[model samples]
Target chain A: MKLLEDRIRRDGRILGTEVLKVDSFLNHQIDPELMAAIGKEFARLFADKKIDKILTVESSGIAPAVFTGLSLHVPVVFARKNKSLTLPDDVWTADVYSFTKEITNHIMIDHRFLVAGESILLIDDFLANGQAIEGLLSITQQAEAEVVGVGIVIEKTFQKGRQLLDGLGVEVESLARITSFDEGKVSFLS
Target chain B: MKLLEDRIRRDGRILGTEVLKVDSFLNHQIDPELMAAIGKEFARLFADKKIDKILTVESSGIAPAVFTGLSLHVPVVFARKNKSLTLPDDVWTADVYSFTKEITNHIMIDHRFLVAGESILLIDDFLANGQAIEGLLSITQQAEAEVVGVGIVIEKTFQKGRQLLDGLGVEVESLARITSFDEGKVSFLS
Candidate 1:
């Protein structure tokens, strides 16, 4: 976790006192070694739970989810943003509103992928308003599956995404929790 | 490669002659163990090339790219479909036509990630008409980066995607080459 926090401080770009761009090493341009370490830490934190599948949204979440899948030795099911020609007709769907993009999109997972009674671990790159995680949780609940926990690469604690998810009684393990942002300076909860 | 061909035969769904759906394992629902093996195989195939970074598109390619990056000990950079608020204004962009989706979208990579003269290895989940690869190649060229080679999980030889890329003088290494798909049966060129 120290590695991630240090890297964020050194390489992260703060824009408009709200957005922290760690694209150089975390999302857009990824350091697989560092990504793998974060995944291993997630596996370690959730060592007590039995995870059958790792669920995530498309795009950004795929890397961390894939790495977590690698360490956990479980399959990863990424919920697609749109209905693709390849995806099946029978699917579990949830509507999520992205405050950043100022748009609402449907995220779906094929019914066959999320089997009933399966233990799911949700993973993503960042948590802002918790819309993405809520959408994923909705899909998991529809399948009658149990959510083991969540593993986030970064968290904006000031956004209170933690409280939003915690209210649902979902356990979250974020590698780096951003406590505040003042005058372009970022602070960590850890 | 045998492992990949075997997986295709077992789990890959053939939709008509144009699409081979491996969503259950390769894309939508990912098998990390199998994904890891594919990455290792890609690293083996491109071992001769000196790759400084692994470049791929977002979503599907992230899993294998992550694995390939792990094996090659290089950073992974995924080109995003749309520009978000977080991405910097300075980026290299390309327009791609998705025959499957019947839509044209732009894929872009940060100018800082793909440096000039850096050797890059392009990785992806599937190659049909080589549109995605071509888009990536265009971005790489804009960055003045050298493309070492391309690592494809599956290539539909019948569609002649390989020929398209090969015509451009780009080296392509596909784990499982599909020769034909007739009567709902898939044939591999392994």
Candidate 2:
């Protein structure tokens, strides 16, 4: 966790008073070694939970979720943002509203992949408004799967996402928690 | 390679005579243990190439590329399919036509991640028509980067992609090479 927090401090860029651009290392351009470490840390944190599978959204969440799947020896399922020709008809889906893109993406997972009564661990890159996580949770609930926990790479505590998850009573673990941004500097929650 | 081939044979679904659905392991729902092996295999294949970075497109490509980056100890940069508010205006952009989706996506790579004269190894989930690879190649060329080789998870020899890459005189290594699909059965190229 300290490793991630330190790297974030050194490489992370602040956009205005809200966005923390980690495309340099976390999302767009990835450092696999760092991702591997982050994966191991997530594995350590959720070692006690009964995680049958790990779920995440496509594009950004696949890297961290897959590495965590590697360490945990579980399968990682990424909810697709779009309905592709290859995708089948039977699927569990939910709509996610992205505040940044200002678009509502219909995210779905194949029903064959997620079974009822399976223990799911939701992993993601950032937890800001919590729309993505909420969508995944909705799908899991529809599938009758139990969401055991959530592992976030970076979380903005100032946002409403943290409170939303807290109200749901799910155990959320974020590697780096940002409390506020002061003068283009990140302030982590102590 | 045997492991991956075996996985495809076991879990891969043949849709009609052209499509091979590998969402069970390769793309949608990922098996990290297999992915780790895949990473090691790609590293072994490109060990001789001086790869300064691993480049691929976002979503599906991130999994294999990140794992490959881990094995090679290099940075992995995935071209974003869409431009977000966080992305800077300065970027190398290309238009990729997805035959499956019937859409032209404007993929971009931040100019800061890729450097001139750096050797890059292009990684992707599938090489059907080689449109994604060609797009990445164009971006790399625009950035003045050298593409040393390409690592593909699956290659359809029946498609024109192989011939295109061959004509370009670029070294390509595909983990599973499919010669044809006979009556819903996959035939691998030996």
- Give the top-scoring candidate (TM-score): 2
Name the top DockQ candidate.
Answer: 2
Over A1-190, each residue of candidate 1 has an lDDT whose tens digit, in order, gives: 8999999889999988789999898889999899889889999999889999999999888888888888899999999996343544698988888887788888999988998999999998899999999899999999999998998999999886788878877678999999877877879985
Q: Chain B TM-score of all predictions, in order?
A: 0.94, 0.96
Task: State in Å the error of residue B73, model 1.
Answer: 0.9
On a 0 to 1 TM-score scale, where does candidate 1 land against the true structure?
A: 0.95
Clashing pairs in 1: none
Could you tell me which residue pairs clash in candidate 2? none
Cα lDDT tens digits, model 2, B30-67, are: 99999899999999999998899999998888899999
lDDT tens string, model 1, B99-132? 9878876899989899899999999988998888
